[model samples]
Target: MAKIGINIATGSLQQEEMIVGIDLGTTNSLVAIIHPESKKPVALKEHNSSSLVPSIIHFGEDGAVSVGETARNYLVNDPANTIFSAKRLMGKSYDDIRKNASFFTYKVIDDNSDSLVKVQVGDKFYSPIELSAFILKELKTRAEHILKTPVSKAVITVPAYFNDAQRQATRDAGKLAGLDVLRIINEPTAASLAYGLGIHKEDEKTIAVYDLGGGTFDISILRISNGIFEVMSTNGDTYLGGDDFDHAIVMKWIREHGIDATQVEQDKMLLQQLRLKAEEAKRHLGQKDVFIDHVGKYQLQITTSEFEKLIDPLVKKTLEASERALKDAGLTTADIDDVVMVGGSTRVNLVKKEVARFFGKPLHASLNPDEVVALGAAVQAEILAGNNKDFLLLDITPLSLGIETMGGLMDVLIPRNSKIPTRIARQYTTQKDGQSGIKISVYQGERDLVKDNRKLAAFNLTGIPSMPAGLPKVELTFLINADGILVVKAKELRSGVEQAIEVKPQYGLTDEEVESMLMESIVHAKEDIAIRSLVEAQTEASQMIDTTVAFINKNREYLEEAEIAATTNAIDQLNQSIATGTKDEIQARIEALNELSRPYAERVMDLAIAKAMKGKKI
Candidate 1:
C-alpha cells in the first residue's frame, strides 16, 4: 500500500510510503510521523513509554552499544566510552577537531586516514557518523514499532550553515541506515514551518530564527510570500551550543576547586560528572534562581548567578551572531518582524531577556523551543508526501560556491544566497605553449586563500593539443542544485571539446569508504543476532536441565523411565545446539527441544510457585 514517488513538478519526492521527518539534532534526534487518519504529527516513542529518547550512545565491554536514554545513564559511570554531543563533529575535518580538542571529552584520532574523531568506547573506536547512526537506528526502531510497519523514507533537517560536504555526509548517513532521504531541509526553515508563519505564501516579512542547540548555532533570515519561503542569508558557528555553556560553568567550578583549568581531560570521568551536574544546574536555573550543591565523586557548589556570569561571554557571542544575521539580511534590528527562538538552550531566562533587549521586540514564545524544528520538518515531510495542500518552501545555498584560479585564488561562480537550482559558467585558457593538459580546482567558502576554505573537488582537463599560451579557451560551467550539491562541466570554446568534471570533496569520506562501512555494519548486525541467539539458547538449555532435575526428584515415584529419558534427551539436544557453530541454527533447535519437553518445564514452574506461596502462608 506504501510506495516511493517523486513530484514531477518540484523535482523532489512527491510522496513516500513512509514519509517521516527527522530532526537529527546535536543534543538529541527525533523521528515523527504524520497520522494519515488524524492528519496530525506524532513523534514516535519507545513501546510502553512516553519519554523521548536521548541522543547518547554508550559502548560497553564486549562491543555492546546502548543508545538513547540508557546510554545517557551509562555516561554517569563511564565517561571514556560514552559519546555525547557528537553532532558537533559532523562534517568537520580532523584538523577542525584538533583546533577545538580542548573542549571535548573524547579524543580525536588524527593518525587515521583523513583524520577521524574516534570515540574510545570501551576498547573500540567509532566515527561520529557511526554514533549518530546508532541514535538514528534507535529512533527508526521506535517508529517502526509504533506504526507496525517498516519506515524507509524520511526528510532530514540540518543546520542552515552546513556546507556541501556536510550535507552530503548527512545523506550518506541516511543511506547507511537504509533510508531514502527525500530531502535535507535547513533546521531554521523547519522552525519557521512550525510557527505556521504566513511567509510561505510571500508576505515580504523578514523573520529570523535564533537557533542555539546542544552543539551548533544557526541564524537564518527568510523572505516569505505566496507560499515560497526563501532564505535571504545565514551565518553561525557549527561548534557553538549549550554544551559550551555547560563547559563554562564547569570551568568556573574547576577554578573554585583549585584545579588547573587545562587539566580537565586528564581525569575525564570527574570532569564528565561535573559537566553533567553543570548541565542540570543550568536547566534548573532556567526555572528558579537558587543554586544547588552538586556533589559528585568530588564536592562542588555553584550558584545560579555565578553560573550566568561564567556563561555571560558565550551569550555575548551569540548576540553578535544575531547582529551578523541581521546585517547579512541587509536589515537593522527594527526590520525583524518577529524573532522566533528555537533550541533548548533558548530556554534560559537570561537568553530570552537578552534577545528581547537586543531586538527591542517581544520574543515569540509560541513555538516549542525544543521541538519546533522537528515539527517543521514534519510539515515539510507532509508537503513532500503530497498531503499538504497549503504551500511549498524553497531554500538557498548558504555560502559562495566557486572554483580555484591562478596563484591559488578563488573565482566565485555562484555567489552565496542564490536561489535554488542555479547555474554559472566561466572560461579557462591554455597557460603555456604546447600545453597538453589543464586542471580545475573547485572550492567553497568566503575565504581569500584557497587553503583556508573547503575544497569541493578537482578534476584534470587533459588532452589539449600543443598550443600557444592563452590560445585555448575552455568554458567551465558550475551548477548547484536545490539541495546545494554541485556539478561542474568544461567545454573548449573554439573546438567544442567538452567533458564533465568529477570533483571529489577535499575532506569528505569517499564512496568506497561508505560502502566498506556499510558492509561492516551488516556483518556486525549478523554477528549480534548470532550471539544473542546463542545466549538465549544456552539460558533455555540450563533452565530445562534444572527443571527436569527438580521434576524427576519431586515425582520420582510416579515418573516413568520413558518420560525421564525423553526430558533428558531434549535437554542434551539443546545443549549440543548451543555448542555448535551457528547459534541461530542451534536456537531454532532449542525451540523445538523446548516444545518436546514443555510439560516437564511448566510443571516445575507451577510447583516452584506453589512452594513459594506455601512458605508465605506459613
Candidate 2:
C-alpha cells in the first residue's frame, strides 16, 4: 500500500490523472512524471535503459517510420533518409534555413517560398511539426509502457528564446501526437523548478540558468517573485554546444593521426565512427586523465587537459553570451543570487569550473543535468493539474483562439491556457493582384478545421492599394484583455489601412463543453491532421497556379512561344495533380512547374532590375 499522488509534506492529494512533463529538445527528448510512491519527479524509462531518446527520425524503404535511437542508428549509413535537429527547423521557412540546410543529412524540400520548411524522404514529405510529432509519439508510448497507464496530457518546455511561431509549432506537434498540451513553459523556468528554486511565494531572487545542450547553448536570467518566474533576458549561440566539444576532440585526433579530411568526408560511415569515438573520448576524459581508443585504424587519444584546451574557446563563447545576457538584463555577477546549471554539457569539469569562477557562486548541479528540464516539466505539470496549490493563475482562455487560413483550416493565434491581457500579431498577404479587401474570421476551438470550431467574429478591411499578389503585408493583431474581451485588429502595414473589432471571447461555454471539445480534438487528432495536410497542399497549389498565370500574363512579350507552351503545359499538370493527387504528388508537380518557369522568371527579373538601374551609379 502506497500513498500515491499525495504531497506527503503538505498533506494534500495530487491529481489522479497523470500529466507528464516533456522536454522536447534539439538533440534528445525525454518524458518525466511524479513518481507516486516517492512523491518526487523522475524521468520514466524501462528497466536498465537510459532515459534519453535521440531526436531523430528515419523512414524505411517501405515508408515505415522509426524514431529516437532506432532512427539515430541510420544517420550515418542512410544519411539521406534520416532526419535530425528538427527542433531547429520548427516554424522555419525555406528562406530562413536555406543557408544552413547542408547541416542536416536528409533532403529538405526546396519550395523556395515563405511557407514552413519540409523534409523529404523518398516520395514522402514531412513538416518539422510532423517530424517532431513522431518523436513525441515515441516518448508518449515509452511513458505509457513504463507507467502502465494512458498518458494523454503533458506540459512541454522550449528554450526561452523560442518565438511565437516556434511555440505554436510545438503545440501543433503535441496535438498531432494526440496529447492535450497543458502548458508550454520555458526550459530555464523548468530547470529552476527542478531545483525547487521558485515554488514558494516568498522566494524572490534573480538566478541565471545556463543550458548547453548537444547543438545549442542558452543563458537566461530570471527574476522570481510570488511563485512567478520572468525571464529578463536570454542570449546564446544556437550552433555551439556539446557536439562541438566532441568535434574538438575529433579534430585533435585527426591532426595527430594525419587523417585526410577529404577521405573522411567521402565516407559517411568512417566519419560517423570518428565522431562516435570522439564522443566516447570526451566522456572518458571527463572521469579519467586520458582517453585511448581506435576508430577504423585511426588511433584516438586525448588527455583531459588537451580536451579542455580544445573546447576552451567554445566554453568561453558561452560565457561571453552569459555576459551579454546579464548586460541585456541590466544585471551584474553580484546581482545573480544563484547560478543554475543545465544541459549535459555542464557535466564537463572545465565547463563547471569556468562557470563557477565567472559567477562567483557554487553552481546548482545536485540534480541530474540531463533530466533536470524534464523533471521540472513534471513539476509544472503537477502545478497545472491543480495538484500543487503553491500558485494561482489569472483568467485564461479555455479554448484556442484562431483565424481561418487558406484551406478552411484554423490557424491558431492564441493557444488555450494562455494568460489573458496578451497580444499576438501575425503577418499575412494578398492571394491575388489588386485584392483590395481581406476578410478576418476568428474562431474558438481545439479542432484543426474551422468548420468544427465556434465562430467568434468576422470582419473585412478594405481599401488596400492595388498591388501584385504577395506584395502587400497585412498584419493581424489579437489583443485579449483581462476581462476576456478580445480586440481583433487587421492592419495593412504598407498601405496604413487598419480595422478593429471588439468581441466578448467567452460566449458562456460551460466547463463540460470545453472538456468535450478538448477530448474530441485528441480523439480525432490523426484524421484532422491528415485533412489539414491535404487542404493545405491544395491551397498552395492553387496559389502557385494563380501566381504563375499572373507572371505569364505580365511577361508574355518577353517570352518565346515554346516557353509559353511549356509553361502552360506545366500549369495544367499541376492543376490536374491538385485535383487528384495526394499531398506528395501535388508537391512534386509544384516543384516541376517551378523548375520549368524559374529560368525565364529570373531572366525577366534581371531585365527589370537592369532597366530600373539604367544610367544609375552605384
RMSD of each: 22.2, 3.1
Which one is best on TM-score?
2
- Give all candidates' CA lDDT scores: 0.69, 0.90
Model 1 clash tally? Answer: 10
What lDDT is reached at residue 430 by model 2? 88
TM-score of model 2 (CA atoms): 0.95
TM-score against truth, every candidate: 0.62, 0.95
Cα lDDT over the full model 1: 0.69
Candidate 2's residue-wise lDDT over 1-618, tens digit each? 865664444455554588999999999999999876687999987778999999998898987899998888888778898888999999899998888888887888787688888887887788898999999999999987776667999999999988899999999899999899989999999999999999888899999999999999999999998888899999998889999998887777778888898887897688788888888888888799988878777767789888888999999999999999999999999999999999999999999999999999999998989999999999989888787787665567899999998879999999999987889999999887789999999999999999999998999999999998889999999989988899999999997999999998586899999999999999999899888988888898898888888889999999999999998998898889888989888888888888888899999999999999999999
Candidate 1 structure quality by residue, lDDT tens digits, 214-307 = 8877878887767666688887777788989998888777777887756766766777778888888888887787666755545666767887
Q: How does residue 263 of candidate 2 score in lDDT?
A: 84
58 in model 2: Cα distance from truth in Å?
0.9
